[model samples]
Target: MKNLFFIPFLFLVTIASAQVQTGKASFYADKFDGHPTASGEKYRHNKLTGAHKSLPFGTKVKVTNLANNESVEVIINDRGPYVDGRIIDVSKSAAEKLGFINQGLADVKLEVVDPGDGKASDPGRPIEHVAVDENEFYEFEISRLKPKGYGIQIGTYQELVNLMRLADNLKSSYKKDVTVQVKVINGIKYYGLILGKFPSRPKAEQFREELKKKFPDAFIVEFNRL
Candidate 1:
């Protein structure tokens, strides 16, 4: 019987080492504007994504609050919960699902369900690859995009034209891409102007510094993409 147990124990150990790992973590919410996230995607508060220091982008994680045993599946999209000793930065929705919104933070357990390509996606870092032109009009930039990322928004306005103008100005100054989008809420339209699908906060903030020269009131927000 002892020998039989030994075989099972070894098997269990091997499986444990081979599969993904889990650890205790503390989550954070989006706090500032113009902060880039790990996976070159913009950060969005309403997203179901999260930031982990080491997990590869596009990896899925199941986070459970040990205190309450509340669990939620968070796709690893960004690079951090940068604070020391913290393991992840979860979206507000994930925190809410984990029943920790009122407390603002919680001690949770995070298990990597997928390892991805072993790189946590950050928005600031640009990965270059071959661009394939499928046709005269379509050019496909073929690179392994880690599928999830975070970005910071510089401003949101009630007028689409104003947002457009701001986005244009930012693009001219930085010589980079700027995007504008319109959102409808309760029949009212609002426009959002954002910059840098950067992978890291430092990179986003660097761009934010330039935008400040023209738009003093610009603030930061998060955007996420699947």
Candidate 2:
């Protein structure tokens, strides 16, 4: 998964839902079954759950198909609709309920369904966690070293060669430092390259200017710390 500044699935969704007021959402069908969800749950495309950019897990939401006004309630179980311009991603069953399974994605109005002081299920223990080292010497050493600067994810794509080539060009022509990495998202392999780390946004912008002159299509993106 693209780990940059992304929230884990489930809890904390209420905080996420509050960020955006309006947008469009879509869904997944047979193609996504058995894939890993943003919350680390294996995505069963048939489940009566969904993935939303925001909205706390277990938060029941009524999605109305704008085209036909058909509505269905579903719990926000995961994160994403990562495709640009989409608000939420529904399971195949939820999409069917919205009357858009036959047409694939649908235009819908997503409203949060408050559970009314209802406590939702925790999505289980997180799959990954950082463990603090107990070795006194190691801890002391780590404390002394100056922190390495943050790395920003400039862009990620399915093509590895494309990312590698871009990295090589950046290294050769520009004195700016860069690195390439691979991340798996719902079984899709994406390559991401970092353009350099700056302590401030203005410095990052300065570096972005030089990058734009070369890779005009490159976009500046912020890396959200996990």
- Report per-prediction Cα RMSD to one decimal: 22.5, 18.0
Backbone-clash count (model 1):
27
**Residue ranges of candidate 2 with Cα displaced over 4 Å:** 1-21, 115-226
Tens digit of per-residue lDDT, candidate 1, span 24-88: 45555457323556556676767778876544456577888888998999877765555655667
| Model 2 residue 130 distance off true place after TM-score fit, in angstroms | 19
User: How do all models score by TM-score?
Assistant: 0.42, 0.43
Candidate that would win on lDDT: 2
Kindly report which residue pairs in candidate 2 clash with one another: 5-224, 13-56, 24-87
Give the deviation of candidate 2 from the true structure as CA RMSD.
18.0
lDDT of 2 by residue, 68-122 (tens): 8998887766667666667778888888778887777777777754321111233
TM-score of 1: 0.42
